[model samples]
Target: MLSVQLFHNFNKYARITEADFGLIEQVLSKKFVKKRRTLLSEGDKSRYIYFVEKGALRSFTVDKDGVEHVIQLAIEEHWIADLYSFVTKAAGNINIEAIEDSEVWLLPHHELELLYEQIPALERYFRQLFQRAYVSLQQRLNLTVSSNAEDRYRQLLQDFPQIAARIPLIYIASFLGITPESLSRIRKQLFQ
Candidate 1:
């Protein structure tokens, strides 16, 4: 069951009402994913905004050379989705897969739209959410262009220490724009 406090927090930040909350609860559903499960695939329309409750998920895309590049990772309390596909109702370019057994709350776009109309505040909340996501994306792009691979890896580790222990080094490597072997070398050097 969704906690009232969580709802209150969201409402306080988003300025939604009780009736709107009830409607959102009715439309949203919970889902579980075992480790390695694929939540969204490239070329599929994204149906939900997934909020992680446990474990981790990674979103990535494969290049022409068949090399996978990580786009983002979401852990407990984080949200993951292909925003383009979710908002535009088009096929997604990225794939979302579970890195570990996970629990998620899924919010469908249409149902969410209903709440948005009935409560304009809900739309404001999502607008703020989009703004934050965009700002983070810009920061990541700046880091990728300006930082070296080792520096990028170090930053990721410093920002999300739990990821160092829970995620496979290879995935972390890809996320940091380094090859797995390169990440291994870095790890070895750091430990020494």
Candidate 2:
């Protein structure tokens, strides 16, 4: 299952041979996490980048007032990691937790480097992944600055309808940078 999704994700950026797929698979380790389990905590060093095979995970940060801000959400076939920590071996400021019972495949930093050397095309694949992530982040920043709260919630619904169905509304509200009551009012207006 994970192999199929992994190969699909890799092939999106580059052509991968069976041998290449096998090589990539060899470096991956599978993990299952229950809902609410924390995979990576704030201030912890990130050791592995995870690819979701099933369920959902969220990355977030807690502010001084203890308000949690959702930064990213990864579902099936998506990748999740504290990229800063994973790349620099520094403490991560974000925490990643399972929003549902999840199955994931992890690639350790060492093995990822080895795989890049062994399978050079993998480097291109990863580069493409980073590029897309950067673009997404930029788009999110633009949306946050330019869009109204209702428009933001609508855009989120248009872009990731599955998120509304899969995660709690409070988390979705946090991700949209709006209060739950505000989101409720927006939803009522939209539906009415």
Backbone clashes in model 2, listed as residue pairs: none
RMSD of 1: 2.0
In order, the Cα lDDT scores of the candidates are: 0.86, 0.91
> Model 1: what TM-score?
0.90
Lowest summed lDDT across 10 adjacent residues in model 1 is found at 3-12
| Model 2: CA > 4 A from native | none
- Output the number of the lDDT-best candidate: 2
Q: Could you tally the backbone clashes for each prediction?
A: 0, 0
Rate residue 148 of model 2 by lDDT: 94
At residue 100, what lDDT does model 2 achieve? Answer: 97
Q: List, residue by residue over 1-192, the lDDT tens digit for candidate 2.
A: 346878888889988888888888887899999999999999999999999989999999999999999999889889999999999999999999999999999999989999899888999999999999999999889999999999998888898888777888888889989999999999999999
lDDT of 2: 0.91
**How does residue 39 of candidate 1 score in lDDT?**
93
Q: Model 1: residues >4 Å from true position, as ranges?
A: 3-12, 16-19
